[model samples]
Target: MTKQLLKPDYIFESSWEVCNKVGGIYTVLSTRAKTLQAAFPDRIFFIGPDVWRGKENPLFTEDESALRLWREHVKNEGLDVRVGRWNIPGHPISILVDFSPFYNQKNEIYTQAWLDYQVDSLHAYGDYDEASMFSYAAGKVVESFYRYYLSAQDKVIYQAHEWMTGLGALYVQKKVPEIATVFTTHATSIGRSIAGNNKPLYDYLFAYNGDQMAQELNMQSKHSIEKQTAHHVDCFTTVSEITNNECRELLDKSADVVLMNGFEDDFVPEKSDFASKRKHAREVMLRIANKLLGTQLDDDTLIIGTSGRYEFKNKGINVYLEALNRLTRDKNLKKNVLAFINVPGWVGEAREDLLERMNSDQNYTTPLKVPFITHWLHNMTHDQVLDMLKYLNMSNAADTKVKVIFVPCYLDGKDGILNESYYDLLIGMDLSVYPSYYEPWGYTPLESVAFHVPTITTDLAGFGLWVNSVTGHEGTLQDGVKVIHRTDYNYSEVADTIKDTVSDFSALSDQEITQIREHAASIAEKALWKHFIQYYYEAYDIALRNAEKRMKKQ
Candidate 1:
């Protein structure tokens, strides 16, 4: 028999930042909150860490009576704490609980780390301690939310994001067994740990010290946590089919639904004259490239570009470099092609160390040495990114008018790179490449098409698969999006493809470029964010339905 669904009186979501700013998760949460609020009226509430304070920003200031009630409640429990509220869009209230007094008294590492973080924030990013505090603060918020927000009459569904808030979910689930619990991992802590940790941590990860590290950082064994959360919740949802398979294989649990990541399609302006837009974009990009490289570029030259976080092995930056190397090696293609690499990473940090070594004349063994020996290395300060002519003098590629430019820094506004220079590059380029080995999902190729440029993505990408299916049989699809079968993260394959694609780019006439633009625009219209909201609602419905079935047996 189909059980009656349990509609939640209130849905509470916890993350590092409710509205201020962070990464892609912040984008997901803020965008979804509006739709959920509209659907459920006053039932939606967001809980988050009260990281900063300001006049314009909303803050949680309880009324005098509520403040007394909280203080007395804390005193009765022999614990000291502070709680506030911040209002974000869609939700009328976002809880901000500061447990500095309680956390400091309990954990010495957390207290010292918090102090160190405040000082580090002024000069550089204090990621380690800031991450620790976020976890600690999240736990406090969960405890406080249960105390203040919970009621016997209320049916609450609490969803926590990432491992930072996993502790809060665990704490609240243990205390309020009656309330439904759900956990979503945007990216697994262990997955990132294994990616970033230079050393091997196989057996030792679950050992006392490793366990402590996980606890201090508020992480679960990626496999174990996801499995446990799946078991505890009525249903589970993950961002991609790739993640869903990983959860099932690693955690021994299958997701109830797959919720793909999406982008705001409306942000991209539309034009009926796509041919005009393509021609203008190309001319603008050439001018920007010529300015950056301190060399003149013709609009007829074929341009290829790649941009993302500066990690070499995972994000396929090295694959791109090797490809450019091979392309330039072919004298036939060398003068006609230019590749722009925009990977923003910290200048003096460990990740940046790779850039420094690659930039130096002193060469590494094989691939790392190739960039310095072959392509140009522009290790400019973040400020110098806008100055193209000066940035170009640092290149290793043969000092032709069209050569490679590597700018290793963060891009904030469009004027710096996006619209002002980066868009011009994309507009001018014949092809864009993203051969990521471990991209959870890819956005570069989709954005490439938005600007009326053709892109090459891997079969492994979720978006790539969708594009390939829609465009594979028709030659029109080839005009816009090309799916390259990346069997592995092999550098040689990347180099060969780079050589072939650049040749193809150089061979394309104005007629072909116009045709590609028309096809790409059509594809972009269907892949917008407005359509993705439906998946979010569907996942929530499943979660709610499962919660109802479990409650009936109880």
Candidate 2:
């Protein structure tokens, strides 16, 4: 029989992505909030930075009536915070702290941190100060909130996400000894730096010393905070087993639990609404593609996409592009492939000529002067995507068998060109691809699968590994996912596999494709928060139990 779990009376979760949409962390927190809310109800609180102090944030809905006295109490305690509910599912109680005031005391905060935990903030640069200040302020917020609202007798757990919030977690450990703490690192700073620098990370993984690598790569401050947080917290958790190995090797501290990321699929259209929405999405996608490329693409044309942060190497944009280029030359290809690079760039604006053409609704056989992108970039010459396309000569010419378009902006329903939310368009895709090399928990591929679009991801991604584990083998496109094997030196081979997968997918019978889409949705259903939230409870259990022991010792 399994052991009984310790549950907290109150939970305080802090993340840089609480009301912000920076990357995959946003999806991780937002999608899982409903399940957390259901479990904890009014007792769970989320703390985040007040980055939008003057301006309004669409993701946040503030309610002055919710925490009426706590708002005044926090301000009187020398912290400016907004007590409200996050605008996402469940509308979880949110506290957005204005970290700007803490910048004046950054040096003092750093000194205290160094004295307490030996964190090396001396080499800080760029986002270090900002993130640290926000973390410190969040810590103060929790301290103030606890002292006023929560009692020492109440069992409380504070969970912090990523190294960006490490200082806050460490602060809570020091200032609020009565509260249990959990620190989760989505991805290690040194690991990402190592991969971003084009170093062979996995090939020489065992040979590398994390401290030495940190020093060599200018990641001393980030590594210090992350390492110290992981070591000091009551519970240290990571997202996946791959990352668990990373923690053991790099931080020299193994995670107490692997909290695999999960999502709630309520955002997905209902079965009654899915068909009409999907059809409308397809119509819009096809019309835009036809207008941009000036080619009359049939409804049978394959619409595939790869979207995430524009990390050319880490997110596998280079390999995805290479695969698309190779697909153009495949003699056995059955359908016209329209591949979209939906990663945002430094966009100048939507292409006026293309927008004008789209508005006219007139047929044009000739392509635009720049048919490869939907938006004008600030530095078109400096952009990696355009530069790579130029190198591969994968222009969307009228005669080309495969056409590539770069949607270099967030698809949040108002990009001027594709006035549709990403999910609205995501459901239209025949296939989605996220071949990330450094992914801890790949949410884009997961989101794609959740939307009933079959996705191709590499085993290096946490989502792909989970798929393999669930399916009991490497997944196939027919199984609604294709888990390609990727490594330090298998770029060319991985590209070829993607090309093959896409080619094979494009040729599948309509009934077979429908079955695959159904399969993909089923796989996604297995990954829902209802199934994976157990690990989070397990983390809470370990923290609470440990905290109880520590309290007794104190």
Candidate 3:
């Protein structure tokens, strides 16, 4: 015997990264949109903050004619919103709300939030007010739309991602009790704060009190809202098992379901053109490095990369640099490794001298003064990557076998140095490493494998843990993704293992490399949305059933 699942007639999802390209959340939502659209075409609505008011947002396409009646009704409800289509694969409907007016009413809004739900705002700081305003505005938009267009008979669902949008989910839960609400904490605030502050998160997770940590880390408001939303939503969900543990120990609740992040393979080049794409990416990347360092690196150079948010210790940029520095002393390392740190930082501008040299056809024997960095950083001495490079004595000298280049700007195809986008150049790498310490679900390593580039990640990453589970063992390069065992205390050991892995990978034959590349693609294929969407369906079912039960009680 089996039970029929309750499916929603309409779904509304809210997130800060809906149109704004900040980090991994954008990738998670944008890639997942087409799949959701296929299931419920024209019924899925994505709400985002209208941060680009009076400016051009290339990621969004606005059509004033879209949902004209609803737009009229929403404007009358005191919401300044734009109905547009997200310029992604599926081109889903998007609403960008102007949340500026809510700033003026924040005191009243905070009071209401406190009365309805115990969301503490006394200690809120930095981006807290801005994110909460947008979240509340989004909730109002959904409530107005539901009141105007939907009925109690309609199966409606609202989902909020991250703590920035938690208030919105709580708001909808109270104001529109008929609509099912879900709160997904990609990573809990206290857990991330503990990890960012260099505290051992997993070892002492159970012993640490969430409220005490919030006070110590100056994160009371954010943690308070996150904790309340997890407990109040019709369904609470998270992205990975590791983060679920954080929810249990820190937030005093567990996720009803774990919705693993899935990759959409439509972005990858076809088999007929992958080789050419890889070649072009490699040529562009090598030319930039050679022109800047005054060294010629041929196609045989082992180009490695590690990129993510510029969290020095959390994203393991420090550890990656340490491993690269240690690899210089490894006698078994036979190949010349040219590594890249593609994390964006406080970039002042592109180097005019490098641009001028790149335009020149002549070859110069002398390297630039600071040959390590691609861009001129706002704080050159204070930048962590450059500081670590100087500490490790990794200057790009003439005879240095391992040359590291720090690209401290986002590669959005317009960074003045590498005109190619991040993915456009990502295909070139011989190996990729994302040894993240605080990653929930690492998109960098997953994206690398999708491009047929063998990647090395650690067990701390959700993707790394998932890979190890699928293979039934911690794998090596032959398995396409090498999952290294990383803990809070094993920094030096992780660096040594990465150095040895890179050294060993360099010695493989051409045939072995091809097989490994194929295996990596297979791993990515298994992680596509077709397989992962079931989790989201399960979440919707739980939310709808709980909502029905609540309505029955009313």
RMSD of each: 9.4, 1.2, 1.1
**Considering every candidate listed, which one attains the maximal lDDT?**
3
Worst 10 residues of 3 by lDDT: 393-402
All candidates: TM-score: 0.70, 0.98, 0.98
Stretches of candidate 2 exceeding 4 Å from the true structure: none
- lDDT of each model, Cα atoms only? 0.56, 0.92, 0.93
Estimate, for each residue in 1-554, the C-alpha lDDT of model 1 and write its tens digit: 95554567778787776645656676667656656777777576676665564344443443344346765675565444343333444544555545344445435533343353211112212343344355445555556556675775776777877645554565555555556667776654444454444322322323324234444444433333334555566556677665555455444556776666665544354566555666776765555444433344576577777887665655666666666655555666534676777666434222243335433445233223223211233443332332333333334433543466554544433323334445444555567888765555667777788776777766656667667666654223345876666644345875587567666666666787688777776776566656676765565667666656666777
Q: How should the candidates be ordered by lDDT, best one leading? A: 3, 2, 1
**Residue 335 deviation, candidate 3, in Å?**
1.0
Give the residue spans of candidate 3 off by over 4 A.
Answer: none
**Cα shift from native, residue 501, model 3 (Å):** 0.4
1 against 3, candidate with superior TM-score: 3
Taking the tens digit of each residue's C-alpha lDDT, what string does model 3 give over 204-229? Answer: 88899999999999999999999999
